[model samples]
Target: MTTTAEHVDSGKAARKRVPRSGHARWLPPVDRPDPVAVLERQGRDRLPELLPIRYGRMTASPFAFLRGAAAVMAADLAGQPHTGLTVQLCGDAHLLNFGVYASPERSLLFDLNDFDETFRGPFEWDVKRLAASVAVAARENGHPAHRAHRAVRETVAGYRTAIRRLARLGELTVWYERVDAAGLLPLVRPARQPRHLGSSLTRARRRTSLQALGKLTEVVDGRRRIIHDPPLLEPAGAGDAASLRKIFSDYRSTLPEERRLLLDRYRFADAARKVVGVGSVGTRCFLVLLTGRGAGDPLFLQIKEARKAILEDHLPSGPYLHPGHRVVAGQRLLQAAGDIFLGWMTGPQGRAFYGRQLRDVKGVADVAGMNPNRLLAYGRLCGTALARAHARSGDRIAIAAYLGTADTFDRAVADFALCYADQTDADHAALGAAVVAGVVPAAPGV
Candidate 1:
């Protein structure tokens, strides 16, 4: 909560500390950490059997590599000069990380969905990561270099515009602002697309607990239980009634009294390991099923292990020793609307874990094969969302002023994104080379 800038002319002060022209600048001669070694260290805590899948997914493309290399980027970001303005960072603020999910009112809302790597860091760090992602994704889709740069510029412009607009409003107004599909459907909906948002929304809506149960579970003797698929959706050994009761109680204790009462209405039924995102493939992720009254009513909660965030060791440690609590706290602070089951608990072996709805209109957007113009539009949406998140958690007035009204910062960011994207490609290639040389184990085409 300390200001690194003078009270007056704060914008000028920030520019002086980290010149706008130097935003694209990176590193100062000394060699960087071995990215392969970093990956090896990260693998130590993950499920051993799933590490091959993680490597295979990461080896898919440069963009996938970036998603899995949060640790490497954190090391780099830590070495850079910062404005000392901190926010509750999503930590991995890539473009694909944002999505549409159902809010408390059942309204579809767009915001940052992944929070496993959430932590406190420089606000611009998140912005830079987002810009890099836009560039990387555009390149993956075979867009021209100029088009990628243009998209990055548009993203920065969107962030600037959103921050300036929010700065003019009251704190409460900024806090309440959200991106809703219903509000945007009329403007963004395309022709001949029968449903709003065309296919994406429809896919998300169909990802209900009942639908998941139908696909992933069946009658096991007298009771219905989850079907197991080795390495992806397997049982986490046999469950102990007392241990399960204790963990459930601990998770419930993290929620508000009202939320706890609401959860109490349902009885626990079954649970299974649920392999999720590319970066999180090796993590211990599981889905719990709860039933209420008739068999028709089913609720699924995803319980995911929370390790020390990628930013934890790089930045000064805070009061949160429990990573699950850190993730829950960061998610609540950044996202306007959060899950009703957003809570944390310490699991067996003292592993931190957080639980949320397995899927409630939870949809992830894909940027691959999108045209330059559409990619630019997607970039704008993500940038605006990032700015809103930072404004909620950081000194909004100072940040808005620092960015100013000129296009200088936007151009600088675009340049930085292009340059760092080149760096990411090199790093990604090194990872692939390492795998080929047997320095890193990998299973390709998974």
Candidate 2:
């Protein structure tokens, strides 16, 4: 095994391969692929009718566009030189993707919540994406460019500081590190902290399977059925419903024997095809409603189709053969605590799908409502959470060595973020133009 000193030396050596300051460059290559074309290619296999909703949501703002354009950014990052410090990346590590969710123990924890695009790659890719997102979000909230730069800097600094701290701990200690949701408030300036944060926490606590039962189901013909919200949420057809029931066993088998027993307590009630997320709108997604003991007992499980990671083509081969398994494994490895019901299985037509609870005290910060100070604090918090996650899967000792005690990497990333935010604005305009020319169909306001 490589000694600790060797690992630290290896990390410092990576700077020679890709200098820390080299990250600031962001000029697009002359032959760079068209962003619209990339989106069109992704939509090729998705539901044709729902593709419009994806485009419509993306056109709402540059930040929205960035959220939906992970593939585009993946390609861009692939073209750049990196530190070669590999980590299981939350490939789409934008601001909104990091949030608070409940562990199996029911304690709320702040961590990376989305994993549809998770894959292994250079650690800097995730950091760059996070920084770029901070810039885009700051611009969207009408913050000045200088303030955006400061926020991005703070983000990278947070990651650097956290990585160094974790490097000093034992293996099990580093592996068990987690960010408690209740501890988040201390990171923000007391005078600038918004009043809504407390209410947001309360709201997240209220967002349980029981709450979903009230909002998404009704008694129809003496049976509790998922309500239809058309184009967004629609009842599954007879064939779809039968297919779901048939596949439930396959998914159940993927779970641990103990978890299977817990799941057995609930009886399958109804299901619906639900549209979800900016990038995932057209993907095959379903919500299965299960009941336990009585009508008051409810459990909601989301089964989402899993495609290849957006960064797959850009990076080397990963361990998992199945896309769904890739997502589940990456989540388990990166998260401090994981969902008990998390599992993956193949569905109809041999498509990969992963299942987990639909709601478990989940909440995301309202980026739109945040002022510059609050956004800065939130960005730093996200940075710290992200570092904790990366430390779990990557070489924390080497990463800390690469970061050193200087702010060089932080400022370079902030510069790149500002430049890339401009690129995102241009790409957002390109998508808008395509919508206007009818080159792509867009169901605005959907």
Candidate 3:
């Protein structure tokens, strides 16, 4: 095992290899692939009819493009030098990915919610992704360039400070550190906090399985069934419904014995095909409804197909052979509090799938409605939460040592964020041109 002093030395040594200032430099390489081509290649295996929706959502805004174009950014970041301090990265760590969700203990906590692209990689990659997202969101909200840079800087500062603090704690303490949504109110300035945050929290608490039962289901011949709202929410065909039922036992086997018993109590009620999220529009996703105790009680679980991580192409292979297992393991390791029902299984045609509660007091920040100050506060909060997550699976001492006590790393990352935001604008324009030239089909306002 390495000593603390040795770990610090290792971190300092990485700075010599990839200088902190080197991160700010960004220019398309001579051999860079066309951004549109990258998106097309990714959509090749996705549902043909749903590809247009993905394209439409991505071209909506530069920030939206950034959210959907993780693979594009993954390639861009891989082209550059890194500190090589590896951690379980939230490969798609953008502003909206951090949100408030219910823990197993029923406490609402703020943390990273999506892990579709989770992988082991250099720690700084996640930081840069978050910073660039802050910059892009700030610009979209009409904030000045200087203000955007300030927000990005504070985000990195939050990550650095939090990592340093976690490094001083014991292993179990670091593992247990979590950001309670209720406790976050006192940390922000009243003037800087968004007024809707409280309402958002209240709304999240109501986003339970019971709430979904009313919104997503209707009575059909004295039977509770998922409402059909075609393309987005359609009832599963007989064949698809049978497949879901057949795979339920496999998914249940992945759970702990106690969780399996809990799951066995709920009788399967209905299943549906659901289109969800901008980037995941075309993926194979299904929602299963279950009832317990009586007709009033409900449980909703999602079984989403998991493909290889975008980072996998750029970085070395990770441990898991099954993509579903990879996602489940990554979520377990990175999340401070994981869903009790989280599990994974193989489906027909050998597709990989992971299962989790569809919604459990989940809430996301309204980035579009935020002012500069509010964006800054939310960015910092995400940064701090991300640091706590990294501390659980990485060497926090080395990461903190690399960050040091100066603002140099923060400033460089802020510069990178501004530069990447510009790249995203150009890429977003390219996607728009593709749509206009009929190169890619787009279903506007879908």
lDDT of 3 at 28: 83
Instruction: Estimate, for each residue in 2-76, the C-alpha lDDT of model 2 and write its tens digit.
Output: 999999999999999999999999999999999999999999999999999999999999999999999999999
Which one wins by lDDT: 2 or 3? 2
TM-score to true structure, per model: 0.94, 0.99, 0.99
Q: Mark the regions of model 1 whose C-alpha exceeds 4 Å error after superposition.
A: 1-8, 27-29, 185-197, 239-242
> What is the C-alpha lDDT profile of model 1 across 1-446, one tens digit per residue?
44434422665678789877678776533778888888889989898888888888888899999988888888888888887767889999998899888898998888899899998888888999899899999888899999999999999998989987887778799999898865654434444443434467778778888887788778788787878887678765575334455799999999999999999999988878878878887888888888887567888899999998988888889668899999999999999899999999988888889999987888766578567766787788889888988889877777777888888888888998888888889888998998899887787766
Candidate with the greatest lDDT versus the true structure: 2
Instruction: Give residue 81's error in model 3 in angstroms.
Output: 0.4
Query: Candidate 3 overall Cα lDDT vs. reference?
Result: 0.92
- Give the number of colliding residue pairs in candidate 1: 0
Ranking by lDDT: 2, 3, 1
When sorted by TM-score, best at the front, the candidate numbers are: 2, 3, 1
